[model samples]
Structure formats: C-alpha cells, structure tokens
Target: MHQAIPYRTWIHANTRDSRDLPLAVRGAGVDSASVAKLVSENAVIVIGRRGCCMCHVIKRLLQGLGVNPPVYEVDEHHEAAVAAHLGAATVQFPAVFVGGKLFGGLERVMATHISGELVPILKDAGALWL
Candidate 1:
C-alpha cells in the first residue's frame, strides 16, 4: 500500500538549490569574518546539513531541552569557514554555539547535556526562559 524512498533519493529531494543560496555565503574557502559575525549575533546557532542524522539529533536534543536554536544548513551557508574560524575544522556539522561562543559538535553538546551544564548555558544565552 505504501512505498519507501531510498535515503539518498530523499536527501536529493530535500536539498536546497544552489541558486537560492546567498551570494555572500561559501563553503571551503569562505571568509572567517563572516562566520564570526554570525556567531557573535545569535544566542544559539547550529551549523549543520539537512540530510545529516546527527544534525537532526542535535537539534532535537536542544528542542527537547526547551531551547530553539537557529539551524544553518552547510549547503546553504559557509560552514567550513565557521568551522575553521572556531578551530573546529576537524569536527564540523551540527556545530553548536551558545552565548556567542563555540559549544562544540554533537559529542560535546551531548556531554554537556549529560553533565547538566547545557541548561545554564542556554539560560545565560537567553535561549531558554525555563
């Protein structure tokens, strides 16, 4: 009665068009200043890819904790530049930033949450009232 789509096909279908992306945004060779500006402005930011399961997990985790972080897709923004700027080139994607600072990726975020440090950070950033 129902058909299941392949993972790759689903990803392709959901991917944003390159033309829709902003001209100022770039991937690997992007400027670090732009990334810094973005991080410094947002209370909570998550740079990730739409098709990444880990990214989804990280977002959901934040939401579960009553925090709504802005998610920027790598395909739509200069994620590499942000990663390099944050000195997290080795661990990008689902990269978290709180209180205008790098909070690390999935592992770090999970560790912080498990250690009960994430809530205070979110509160400090004004991302969570509760």
Candidate 2:
C-alpha cells in the first residue's frame, strides 16, 4: 500500500518541521491571518477558490458594475481557512468583502444587486465612481 502526503505538508519529509515555514509558504500563499489582513487593507476583495466558477461569476459581476475588486484565488486548503475567518455558516466561495467587511456570498450579492443596493455599496467602498 502507498501513503499520501497530508495537506500543507507537501514539503519533503526530511524537512525539520513544517511549522518552520512561513504561513504563506505552508500552503497556497495565504494563511488565515493573511486573509484577514487582506480584507482589512482593501476597499473590496474577493477570496475564492482558484478554479471555481462562482469566483468567475462574482468577478464578472463586479466588473460589469464598474467595480474592479482584487480577486485573491486560493487553493482548497486555504479556502477553508478563509471561510472560517470570514465567519460564514458554511463554506462560501468568492467571499466578498466591501469596505473592509464581509459582504457575504453570491446569493447575497445577487440579492443586493436586485435590490439596487450594490452600486451604492460599491460607491461607499470606494470601488466605484460617483
């Protein structure tokens, strides 16, 4: 039988300890702390899985609305960490942060857009022009 490497432990087994690696180095270039920091530093940012369709949809939607948010694509390992930091009830991909706050997922975004509040929110976030 063959064994597999545990997540975030893709480094060679001979390495002293995975903990020695920086948080960003341990996995997909993001730790929970980095994710939190990214949210706080940006007016708007979307943290989503690398190849997720919802991520694409969210990005396109924001662009269509004249808001270009920085989309940080994380791999699956980083996704769960980000989700927990985002405080979502479940794993929500393409988690939106507006004005340095969690703005929920795709459904919430769609609802806000339908309600005509997305533009105002984007304006407040400084992600869109007046």
Candidate 3:
C-alpha cells in the first residue's frame, strides 16, 4: 500500500519553483511580489487575452470542471510585465495557476485532465466540491 501525497506538495514537487526563476523572462517591468500575491490568494486564476480562442477554451474547461477562476485580461503594455512576472516567455496568454502555484498553460491543464489528475488537484485547491 502506498500513501497518497497531498496535491499541493505533489504539485510543488512536480512544477518548477517560481522563486528560483529569473526575475523576468524579458528582463523588464516585472513585479514578482504582486504576481506572487495574486496567485497565493486565488484558488484558481487564468491570465489571458480577451479575444484569444485558446484563452476561451481554457476558461470553458475550468468552468466545465465547476471552477470559477478569476481571469485577468492582459493589455498590450502590461503583457510583458505579466509574462515576465509569471516567468513565461513570449507573452503566452491563458497562463493557469492553481493553489497559488503556476500550473502552466492550456496544454498542461489538458494533459493533467487527460491523465485524470486534475480533479484531485482541483479538489485540493478547493476549486471543486466533488
């Protein structure tokens, strides 16, 4: 018999620690503290563009899972700053965060869901009642 590890610890161990990441991927206007605070307080957060199709898909997926994640639409000027703060390159939209940890983008979320791990993670993060 194997003991199951809590999703938070499992996620922390699986994902790269944001603290060890460089201040900014693009090296400009990155406020690490603000990014950290936003993620920490929100059980789930999706930062994406208002008109991006992929962003819509991500939001829909979360909603289908019974999650009500906050979405922050990135404006042109703040795009770089948000990307850098999240340690993401090239201003990727729809960055996902769960339980105050960076959970990558749509592909990662989909992969986790396909692997049947997303529900446990959502439950652990208090984003799911079931």
**Number of the predicted model whose lDDT against the real structure is largest:** 2
1-130: candidate 3 lDDT, tens digit per residue: 9999863211111123444332112212335675656578678877775456787688788888888676655556777777777766764667888897778888899999999999899999988878
Off by over 4 Å in 1: 1-34, 76-79, 85-89
Q: Please list the residue runs of candidate 3 whose C-alpha ends up more than 4 Å from where it truly belongs after superposition.
A: 1-35, 87-91
TM-score of each: 0.65, 0.71, 0.67
> Against the hidden true structure, what lDDT does model 1 obtain?
0.66
Show the colliding residue pairs in model 1: none
Q: lDDT of candidate 2?
A: 0.69
Sort every candidate by lDDT, greatest first: 2, 3, 1
lDDT of 1 at 87: 69
Rank ordering of all candidates by TM-score, starting from the highest: 2, 3, 1
What's model 3's lDDT at 28? 27
Candidate closest to the true structure, highest TM-score: 2
For model 1, the run of ten residues with the poorest summed lDDT: 7-16
lDDT of 1 by residue, 1-130 (tens): 8999753212121223522333122233344564566567668877776557887788789889987665655664555555667666475677788888778889999998999998998998998887
